[model samples]
Target: MMLAELVTTADRVGATSSRLDKTDALAELLARADPSELPALMGLLLASPRQGRLGVGWRGLTALDITHADDPLLSVGDVDAVLDVLAATSGSGSAAARTGILVDLAARATASEWDFLVRAMLGELRTGALSGVLLDAIARASDRPAAVVRRAAMLSGDLGETARIALTGTAEDLESVGLQVGRPVLPMLAATAATTTAALEITGEASVEYKLDGARIQVHRQGDDVGVYTRSLADITHRVPELVEVVRALPVNDVILDGETLSLDEDGGPRPFQETMSRFGAEVSRDLVLRPWFFDVLHVDGRDLLDEPLSVRLAELERVAGDWRMPGLVTADPEAAERLSRDALAAGHEGVVVKAIDAPYAAGRRGKSWVKVKPVLTFDLVVLGAEWGSGRRRGWLSNLHLGARDPEGEFGDPGGFVMVGKTFKGLTDELLKWQTEHFPEHESHRTASTVFLRPEIVVEIAIDGVQRSPRYPGGLALRFARVKGYRDDKSPGEADTIQALRALLRG
Candidate 1:
């Protein structure tokens, strides 16, 4: 297929607010794609290339002085080939090679195609075709069940692979995709509630488990071999040898355990989140030992428990994890739930997650099955822009300008975000350095004092509450906002909504 064709379809997908229309446009595109092209095609449509980060940033693209072609000619395969070269090019003199390659590619693509290509490379594609929507498109194009496509994608942890399989293979082939002891699956996510009582109202007779402020990990063990993965399913087994050893010590011969790991202080209390994350991020650091707190068991001894109810899974988890199981109690009483929440908070943990005892694990889906309750007011907001620091913090992006999601276009563009607040508080020197090094990669534009970024980085912010304000588009502003941490696991689409933030006024 022509890259122009994909660009045109993406334009169509972005032009409408109707999800049905978006799905239809994407399905039409998918129907015309060759089986071998689905992976690269899906990756482009999702603005996440199959080759991963191509080392091409917006600054590199803007630095090109080549003129785009007038005629449409670049094929999807051509773009994929270029990206392959770009992904492979690195080390000394790689910048010049990448720039030379970009110049040739840019000169080959038409103006519109070049625009789409730039957006795709910069991770700024604004089409409403999210993973879920594209899964529907794949189902429609392949004449398969949406549930089957979704399940396959979740289990395989690759949308492009899932699309290829669904588009080319039979129902039996798709169904054959099941939990593997070595491969990582998507972790189940949680919705949020104001209180444990409210969370219990969502999940009756719930397992009120402590919500640890730590890095999420999925450990898969077979015999003595174990692999550890982050929340995004990136393999980190070599980096987390202590965790691998812990999983290897489990009595079961084969298991897939989902849990959080954090470094504990001398008193056995959880360390600060950043300290835990710093330890987690290090390639080799044995000074800080991270302990696993298993919360859910997905597979054990050749048996898959993803289809089983939470109560059954928890029983299996307790049997396998013993003292390592996350602390919680099964209860229907609101008071008991509140007590657990208080105890969790008292232990320096985040709060509590109330999960329905009978709900089956729905990987990669955030539904009402599990609800997290935090007494502190915290919301995930996108980093719209960051200002350079002053005084002791000079030369770092310190003051964060936060934006809340405007999903319905009530306050701004649909699926865009509205600026709600700014903060320089709670930023450590390490975080400041990170902002300085990485913020430029996401930069949309810049001024003397601030560098505006594409709405892609999600950061968790704690606020006292919201107050009415005439300074912002949303007519509400965050009060006393401070950084909790960057949520590398989440996307801009998953950021908290403006409506949800404004709801604080009522409280």
Candidate 2:
């Protein structure tokens, strides 16, 4: 297929508010796609290339000066071949090599094709064709059940491959996709509540566990081998050998554990989140040993527990993890849940996650079965721009202009970010220096005072709440907003929505 066809469909997907219309357009496109090209096709539509990060950034793309072709001549395969070269390019002269390749590719593509290619390379396509919608389209085009396709995608943790299988393979092949002991599946997610009591209202009788401010880790163990993956499914096993040894020591020969890992101080209290995160680097620090605390067990003793209730899974988790199990109690009492919440906070943890005792683990889905509670409101927001600092913080990009995801474009552009407010609080000297040095790489444009970004960075912000305001297009502004930290594990697409911020107005 021509690259122009995909770009036109993307434009059509972005121009409408109806999800049905979007799905129909994508389904039609999928129907015409070649089976061998499904992976690359899905990757382009999702703005996540099959080759992963191509080392391409906004600055690199903006540096090229080339006039695009008036007529579309590039095929999808032609663009994919170029991306392969760009992904493989590295070392001393990689920048020049990439620039030359991009120049040639740009000259061959039409103006619209070049625009789409840039957005795809940067993972910033603002079309409403998200993975869920695309999965629906695949199911529609393949004449398969959406649930089957979704389950296959979730279990395999590869949307592109799942698309190919669902489109070309039989129903039994899709259904056969199951929890493999060694392959990491997507982690289950949670909703949020103001308090443990409120969370219990949503979850009923719940296992209220301590919600640690640590990195999410999914450990898959088979015999003596263990692999640790992040929330985004990036394999970091080599970076965390200590964690691997810990999982290897588990009594069960084969198991899949879902939990969080963090470094603790001498007193056994959790350390700062940033300090814990640093353990994820390539260099293993013997001084900072990370400890694992298992919350849910997905598989044990060659049995898949994903379909089991939380009550069953927690029992299995206790038998396998023992002391390493996350601390919590099963209760329906609001006062008891509140007590656990206080204990978690006093222990320097985030708060509590109240989980329904009877709900099965719904991987990749954030349902009401599990709800997180925190005394103070914190949200994941996108950094839209950063102002040049003043006074003691001069030469640093300090004040962050934050944005919320506008998936439906009620406030502005569809599938774009809506500016909510700005803040300069909670930044340490290390963060200030880091921002000053790295912010230019993502620069979209800049004035004398501020440098606007491409909404690629996700930062966790603590806000007292949100107040109704006309100063921003979202009609709401963050109250006493302060940075908690950068959530490197999350994507801009996972940032909290403007409607979610607006709901704070009602509270």
Candidate 3:
């Protein structure tokens, strides 16, 4: 098994959008991969190593050195030389090293090498493949059931665990089988419906609470010790010591709670989502104006509430959280819930999440048990730039540069706006066409098809909230902001004022 073969399969997978072709190509590649390299291969296939969230990376040269450095069997200079070759060939260290290492090992290498290397390195080998697909492939290759292989891969966080499980029938042979303190488990998610008609059918009631625009967090506490994790399962305990302290102060001992961590203003209202995100660091002061609002409990005193109905869990949650819980909690009442939802929106919060009282907790599942609704506020904003879209949106404007009014002359010249982040949603065919025509007029720079536009056109945008941002020159960013329409009626001066933004921030 050589790396060249893996690269070839990856090239085929990347070029075609057909799932069947991709799977077949992947199967062929997996067949040729050495048993030891299967984990890395699986990671490459799933775009896991490229995700960067899991701490596994493929930044060409730096990644190549780090990967080889972990191998006790390989020499330092050997890894460095491989990285050097990779840098020369691809200019991206790890991708080049990956190709160089494979080509150097195999005497017969050809034009296919370039194709394979490019696809694998770019991490664009999408073939309509799911994690389940790769699991089955590994099972078939190693002579194991897909379930056994899936569990091994998940428990060990490595595909080699699948091969090991297949070769050795014992489950104990798998590494990191038990739940570890720092390890991340996929957090449970809820399915949502858009309209009240759908909500009534799903829960038989319109019962809902306002859904604040904040980060979802899971807190695990054991007596005095506590840990907090994001929805992505990243351990952010060190970044949020205030949350740890708060969880530790809970009345009950040994508990697992699910909640949202938000930044609040001095008046105790929820701050912008961006502000909460900016506070995620070790150096963030303890006095930082942020708070954690616990919503549900999954485990308490070593007891798992996963099998219990929502009603039962809510009782436990209320008992444990008490005053620390989120503001609104309703039972089977629909009308009252709707009022609360409206009040949340009027107060400048996002929409609400409605959960069924009797629904059991389903971990890592998005079913019709829970729903989220947010009030959309639309304002005319200027476009600053566009990033090239990928996959289905490839070649079109993926994200747009958004800006708000600056009457105070604080951001730029009087009446001038600043660059916020970009968004891909809420664009109509007409708007896209208009942008394509007018964007070039304001083009300050161009990289490929992506053009940086001058802030001129006033495009209407609907947003969830406004939050403080370090990236934007205006010192603010929009939450879940998307295009609504082009505000042909209003000029740039008629756009929402900075005072309104400040009031929303206060709210």
Candidate 4:
């Protein structure tokens, strides 16, 4: 297939708001893709490369000076070969060589094709359907069950490879994909709820486990060999040697465990998230040892438990993890679940997760089987500025720069606002239209991509909490911030203070 075909299909996917239309567009490509080129084509459509990061950023793209071709002639294999060379470049004068290669490739693409290529390299192909939509597309093209396709993709931890197999092979081949030790499978995700009581209401007679503000880890061990991966299945076994040692100590020789790891202070309490991240990011943090807390076990003693209930997994986990298991209780009563949640909070943990006892592990997707309940703090903050949107949000103001009141010039000019962070979530199309129409009326200044607004509009923002940060002058920033709604009746002086957010970092 030509590169133009994929680019044009991506344009159609982005232009439509209908999910069915997006699935159809993707199905057409998957049905026509050659078996040999399926993996590379799927990677491009997903805006990620099988070779990982190409070491090229927006700055490198801006340095290129080339005229685009009037027509598209680059084949899928040609683009794949070019990206392979780009990924292999390293050290010395590789940056200049990368620029030359990019220029040559850019000169072979049309203007629209060039725009799509830039987004693809930037990993921001905003097609409405990625994993979920593409899963259906694969099933449609292969005449297979969606459930079987999802399981194959999740267990293999590679949607592109799964597409190639499903497209070229039989249903038996898809079913052959199973849990393998030392090969990380996608970790199961959780949905959020307002409280443990609410979460329990959804999943009755569930296990309520303590939720930690740390990193998700999937530990795969087979005898003497063990591999640790992050939520996205990136191998980080080298960074967490302590964790590797802990997993190796497990009595079982073959096991795959899902858990969380975080650094602790001298008092044995969980440390700040930033401190944990600081240690996790380092290749070696000898001073800070990360401790692992297993929550769910997928395989044990050469027996697969992914299709089993949480009760069965818990039995195996208790036998292996012992004291390392996440603290939790099994209860059918909402009141008991609430008590456990309160205990978790009293112990300085974030919250408790309520999970169905009979549900199978649905990997790589956020299913309703497990629900995470964390307390959210809402504040009326001022909108300092907003940048131009992309993909589906194009031609509108998005990614709002949030600020809190600074009455005494604690951070910015006196009486000015101090920025906490930016958020582009929780906005509907109507809200986007309203902001585009009214934000310019209050624009104090403008840039190529952003419009600075007067500190007059108050917006309600929700956050998990605040954390210590050197990026903002306020000495703290919001964690997982999202816009709740515009506070039309609130004044700038009535907005929440920076001290209010800073106080969250303590509690």
lDDT scores for all predictions? Answer: 0.89, 0.90, 0.61, 0.84
TM agreement with the true structure for every prediction: 0.90, 0.94, 0.60, 0.76
Residues 351-411, model 4: lDDT tens digits: 9989999999988767789988877756779998999999999999988999998744556
lDDT of 2 by residue, 208-265 (tens): 9999999999999989989999998888898888899888888889999999999999
For 1-507, candidate 3 gives per-residue lDDT tens digits of 454455556556546555455556666666665555555556555544422322112232122321221212322223234434443444346444554564452223334443333333443333434455566666665555656566555533445446545544454454324333334444555544444444646775433656776778888888788888876556778888888888888888888888888887877778766567666654656565568888778778867676688778888988999877876765556666667777887776777778777777665555678866555655567776887667766656657877776644466444456666578787766656667766665566888858886554667677777798788786667888887656433345445555455545643
Over 4 Å off, model 2: 67-70, 283-286
lDDT of candidate 4 at residue 504, scale 0 to 100 = 62
Q: Look at candidate 4 and tell me the lDDT of residue 483.
A: 73
Clashes of each: 0, 0, 10, 0
Per TM-score, the best of the predicted structures is 2
Better of 2 and 3 by lDDT: 2
Residue-level error in angstroms, candidate 1, position 460: 0.9
Instruction: Give the candidate order by descending TM-score.
Output: 2, 1, 4, 3
Candidate number with the higher TM-score (3 or 4) = 4
What RMSD value applies to candidate 4? 12.0
lDDT of 4: 0.84
Arranged by lDDT with the best first, the candidates are 2, 1, 4, 3
Judged by lDDT, which candidate is best?
2
Query: What's the CA error at residue 356 for candidate 3, in Å?
Result: 2.8
Cα-based lDDT at residue 3, candidate 4: 90
